[model samples]
Target: MKLSAHVEKVPLIHPFHITGYTFTHNDLLVVKLQDGTHVGVGEALGVYYKHDTPYTMLEQVEALRPTLEHGITRKELLELLPPGGARHAIDAALWDLEAKQRDMPVWQLAGMEPPRPLLTTFTLGADEPEVMATEARGFEGVRAIKLKLTDDALNAERVRAVRAACPDAWMMIDANQGFTRETLASVLPAFVEARVAVVEQPFPVGKEDWLDGLDCPIPIALDESIQDHRDLGLAVGRAQVINIKLDKCGGLTEALILAHKAQEMGFKLMVGNMGGSSWSMAPGFVIGSLCTVVDLDGPIYLSADRTPAVSYHDGHIWCPETVWGGPVAA
Candidate 1:
């Protein structure tokens, strides 16, 4: 078997900013595993918010040369590395390889009875409220739209614009850990008035307990606040929803497990993304089928993606043929 990796810096068509900072480009790690016959590929985008950089993720993968060259099992792969971008890329490639090897779909091997179509949240990038609202109103068949919010004082105006643009749209907001208690309190009322469905990770992780039992008008979602399945125990009662990002939870293996656990705990599920090409959206596409809200619009941000890019024909993303690779779209 042979293992190889490289990084692709994908420039966002438009600069993307949340509350914290603006990201102009994403460094993606692409890995290829082959046994001198079939080839399997996967990718992960470097996430700055998680303290992850392309250089760091590359070093981590290089350090795992021994394991990669040894034909490591997926379970051993999990035990060998802590959850992050590197494992996510490699694990996904392995799943793709295994499915191709057996001539079956990856979902079939994972024990998912039948694959179903998924509805994903159309994300309105960080921009003025009126501009974001214009983008939201243009979307078709998207049951939910997650707006990226910031610490700026104009949050109320932004919410108002979006609500006015899509009065009937099921709306949600993600602060990306960009708000304070006072600021969040001030905006929660406006968000509720605008019928914003849920607010996500308004504060940083540890401080999230501040909202525990506070009873805000809208439900709160935990994004950066929750890490892995272990973190679930601490967040179970505190958060109304869990935004599961495969890169954050390790890979699809842990993501599925965490989703099941979150479901059992009565928390709503929201599959999210960190931004990449179509490849980055593949794993999340499968997970979105089982979640209440889906935020897998990572591919849409890229200038160009791998062939057969996850087709977003209405508001639904099609995953008939892996979507990451395998066949080119006609």
Candidate 2:
């Protein structure tokens, strides 16, 4: 096997803002693993909060070229890398490679039923009340919208405006750890009134216990707080849903492990994206079959997507077998 990696810059259609960072482009790391007969490709946007840059991911993967060329199994690869983008890219490529090498789909290997088209949530970055409302209204045929929120007075106004704009759409908010105990409490009334389905990472990581005081009605979701299976213990009473991002949890290898454990503990599952082209979103698309909420809208935010890419229609995302995991599209 041969290991190769490079950086691919994907411009975002609009500025993407969360708690403390804004993205205008995705500097992704694309990795390829090959055995003379076939080649497999994978991509990762890297985790922004943890500073997992493309170059860093590249260096991390490159350092293991010797061992990778010697051919490493997915489970062994897990111990060689921590849960992040470097591992995510390689892990995904391996899945793709194995799927073709064995003439099987990644989902079948993962013990999942045939993949189905999934309803995905189109996300809107943080903006003014009216601006966000306009953005939400602009999404034709997209019935689920995930609103990016911040720690401020306007968070409530933002949700209220969007809810009014798309009254019948399913609404969810991801604070990206922007709220404090007080701020989350302050926004609870408007969130409830707006019929917001869930509030994600309302309080920053390590403050999972903040929900102890407020009898909040909207269910909370844990994103940044739970990176992998090891962190599942932190979500017991803090959140009702766990947003699994391949970039954060490494890739499908760890994601499947995390999802199973999260489900067994009674937490609803959500598969999300860090930000990349269809190559990155495809793996999560497979995970979507087992998830209650799917947020693989990364390609929707990009200026352009790869060929044979995943498609968005009506209110769902469809990935063909030629796009990603098992023969490409998982």
- For residue 39, what is the lDDT in candidate 2? 83
Error of 1 at 309 (Å): 1.0
What are the per-residue Cα lDDT tens digits for candidate 1 across 160-261?
998888777788999888888889888888898999988899887688677777658788889887877888876766778999998888788889989999
* lDDT of each residue in 33-148, candidate 2, tens digit only: 99987788889988888988889999999999999999999999999999999999999999999988888888998999999999999999998999999988888797999999
TM-score of 1: 0.94
lDDT agreement of model 2 with the native? 0.90
Give the range of the ten consecutive residues with the poorest summed lDDT in model 1: 321-330
lDDT of all the models against the reference? Answer: 0.81, 0.90
The residue ranges of model 1 lying beyond 4 angstroms of the native Cα positions read: 138-142, 325-330
Misplaced by over 4 Å in model 2 are: 328-330
lDDT of 1 at 103: 71
What lDDT score goes with residue 173 in model 1?
91
